[model samples]
Target: MRLKETEPEEIKLNMTAMIDIVFQLLVFFIMTFKVVAMEGDFNIRMPLASQNQEESMDEDFPTIIYVQLAAGTNGNINSIIVDDDTTFSDTDMYSKLTQLVESKIAAEGNPEDSKETEVEFDIARELKYSYTVKAIEAVSGKVVDGQIKKLIQKIKFKDSTSF
Candidate 1:
């Protein structure tokens, strides 16, 4: 019996199409990428609750100013109230808020008071987000002679459902 010998054929995969697909995917992802701006810089410090009630009720405790942002029917800021007394509903609400915050800081009679002061924002659920941000900016700080003068460093948000 006679046997026939056969040679094995080399198998070559066409990688050009695979490389093209990889480049296309890279280009698509690059084109669809988006850049977003940075968020606001806020410094907040919350200490643990005191076990002693007397210490919590101390007279030297840090001052907490409440800011109430009431919204109108149109979701616009109707009034900006500070401590349930001072209210600003004029067109320049933000400026008034900034001034009030600044005055409060100055009234402490010490430059170090700004760090100890805290602002609690009680914003209406219907208020526009922009208005809330403006109010925050007003109390956060102000630009003085091209320099930023930091005001109250601590900020907190109250329960909206309570309003």
Candidate 2:
């Protein structure tokens, strides 16, 4: 007896479900993505190390203002010190700092001469990043009524052992 010829069945994968799942995942990720605002947008001019230190020091050397941030045990700023002579609490930081910068500029004979001054933030390693930003903003100056007054344009950061 002769056996009947048999034909093989073709198996095919249904990719529609897989493609749909992939598209769903892409949409989920895209929808869940977050956009964060940038921190510290102030334009501060930093000193370059390539220039001759002696030459700059001779005549046009920028006046240095030291700002020290003392951190408390809770990681917040406990005290703010300017030039190591005056200390201010956090509540009065902005006003006092602005006053100090304004007074310094006034003493220079011309408010425009304040650009020749440099603010050095000698921050403690243990301090929080917020404190540093606060210190920078303090000396960055503010707008009064309608005029935009800039206190110091140049800024520097230094390491300090104490808080």
Candidate 3:
């Protein structure tokens, strides 16, 4: 009697195609990654006027406060003098900022009638993140309800410069 014929083994799957598809998907993801930057900057386009109304007080304002930020040697912001002060530090900066805002609010009396307060940081071109962040933090703390904003009035350093 003839022996029963043995059935052939099923063909195995070829993982090469699967691997290629996976590689293609990986490459697609790498190429499609989004580039988002956190640094904020102000737009520099001044609107043109019809030249009818006369401009007044463009150069000097009496009620403006100047805050200067400088990178200290100790690296923890040792000196952050507001307007003019001999000695100051990061810890005292917030208190001073709060006091200033409080004084301004007190002087204004009515919250609605009070003029919008602006804080300026005359920062150096080579200023570091440590100094800038502290200034921002101080201003934020001083302004209740997060109204205090650090508007980028001037960027001293060029775009090429990295801080």
* Per-model CA lDDT versus the true structure: 0.83, 0.78, 0.52
Per-candidate TM equals: 0.66, 0.67, 0.45
In candidate 3, position 110 carries an lDDT of 54
Q: Pull out the clashing pairs in model 1.
A: none
Clash totals, every prediction: 0, 1, 0
Candidate 2 lDDT over 41-142, as tens digits, reads 777554455443544667766788888888888688888888999999858776788899889888889887887787878777889998787777778777
Give per-residue CA lDDT, model 1, range 40-107, as digits (tens). 65555555445333555875667888999999989988999999999999999899999998888889
Q: How accurate is candidate 2 locally (lDDT)?
A: 0.78
lDDT of 3 by residue, 106-159 (tens): 686654423344455666656667667656555534444867533223222222
Pairs of residues clashing in candidate 3: none
Q: How far off is residue 145 in model 1, in Å?
A: 3.6
